[model samples]
Target: MSRTVPYQPVLLRLLHSAIALLVFGSLITGFMVYDRYDKRFGTLNLPIIRDTQGIHGTIALAFLCLLPLFAIYCFHIGDRRLIQKESFKQLQEVGKPIWWISLQRFANSLLLVSATFAVITGRMMQEEWLPTGEFNHVWYIGHLIGWLLMFVSVAIHLLMSAKVGGLPLLLSIYNWKIRPEDMPKFWLRGFKLKPSTTFLFFFEAVVIGGIAIAFILPLIFTSPQ
Candidate 1:
């Protein structure tokens, strides 16, 4: 008889599934909006959606609202696998190459930062600005940058996941074989504060706070009112 791989906790699977769906939806709709509105960077041959902005906005709102819950889960429970202190400690082994799991953690961290930046800058964008070809607006610029970062970050994340654990690990989150012990109720225990949790909090705050300040401060200083 073959041994079954360990099952992901119900809460973690649910949250990860929701986040993955939202991220993909946001990316598709956001690109459609960009293709329709801005061509300075060149345009794709994809079909132009007349209401891309509306679709994108709806997806963005959903993503923005749900992201906090996901963040909470990540900060509270997901940080253990995410922080990868063992990987960092391996840095001392000068001749040893970093493991795929370590690279995966780093990629995941970048994805979180990129997602937060995309959501913040996206919220600051107005529909009128995009339709009027007002691509030069500060928030729009930030949104564009965030979009690029998100695209790259997601690509890296997917690649790293594939390299680290292959299809089984990737599919584990979607598996329906949750054991009796893997119920959602027990997931909270993973959130206990370890030394690594502090590092995760600080990393997220810096990425999010730094981007917010960079874009928001300019508006505050330049406002005519």
Candidate 2:
């Protein structure tokens, strides 16, 4: 008996891989910045990197830039992987395979929400605040909590995916073999924005607009002051 490996779309793999790398970089550099500045929880004995904050911000900005495209793809094309209208009802079927699948979908949705939370809060943060010993800002606290939630969400996401799809499913995202239909050249041909996803696309647009405003407002207020 052989385990079956499911095929993943090449665009999904590319977007997922890029986002994963950016998230991982942001997490490590975020910790380094935290350790360098505010260590109320406990400090690491690592050598200080003066530019960790800047590096973290750069990675975060990259994540922000990529998020809208990823969100659009996920909501429109990969919507099945996210929580559905029947998800909650399916949860009542505990111990059934559908229960696990529903749980995985919920976890997948949570990852998106938490990632957005972390990114928005991060965009609202000021680089100088932590270095200047201002550790209690509401945005900073929210950012810290957001990242913590995102870390937990990521773990839950992996566990749920493993539970639902097993190792083969886990490896599917990294599968490099692309079906002829999923080729980049044919993507536009198959891509149809369904009316059902209109609301989601609008919500994503609002979030992206909010992020842009968050990124721009500080500069506007602080300029030449």
Candidate 3:
């Protein structure tokens, strides 16, 4: 039989699946929530809240509920590099600057804080629920800023993930039951593969650039409600 490799953590698989769904849902609703504020983001062609409130609030609330669990998982995995700045000290000897770690921490902090505020504000804005003040006001201001922060944070997270053996670590979550044949290849430091040349390097840039561009375009020249 052929061989295979699993790169993510077993626990991460469960958490990532949960996180992915909730996050995607959260993003959808976020689009709706933001639609209420500034319906334009260049040529990205996004929809406003008026376009869809279907699950925006629900996912926002769910995300609020799910975050604590995720926090626990992050701690359980010994991956506190984001919150625990001291953990990154080991990388400093290789000419890697300390500032990078600080920046990573800041990015992580921004994502959590912004997401937290957005969730709180979102709950407050819900009409069918609590006795929150009208969401039609300046709360949009906070939400807009928070969303922007999240976008920036995710960008940094993806970049940093790659640098820190994030691919195998993330993939490891799937528990793919790595096979024996893949061992030699991995141990070879990819040297046995003809020291290949391929488009793999450009893959991430394309994906990240694509999403960033897509999000920004709708804000620019599109009334795509």
| Per-candidate TM-score against the hidden true structure | 0.82, 0.88, 0.56
Runs off by more than 4 Å, candidate 2: 1-3, 188-190, 195-225
Cα lDDT tens digits, model 1, 69-167, are: 776666667775565656687545544335656777778877878888787677667678878777888788988898899889889888877766677
* Residues 1-225, model 2: lDDT tens digits: 134888787888899999989988988888888888899988885699878898899999999889888877877778788777778899999999999999998898888777877886787787789989999988899889987888889899999988887899888988887688776786544354762455556655565566566567566665212
Comparing 2 and 3 on lDDT, the stronger one: 2
Ranking of all predicted structures according to TM-score, beginning with the best and ending with the worst: 2, 1, 3
lDDT string, candidate 3, 1-225, tens digits: 112443544444556677667867777567655455445553345543453555666676566666665544443342333445343464455545454555555555455555555554444343432123343454455565666766666777666544444466445555656546445343323222211213222422333343344335435633311
Q: Candidate 2 at 49: error in angstroms?
A: 2.1
Model 1 ranges off by over 4 Å: 1-6, 84-98, 193-197, 207-225
State the C-alpha lDDT per candidate. Answer: 0.74, 0.80, 0.50
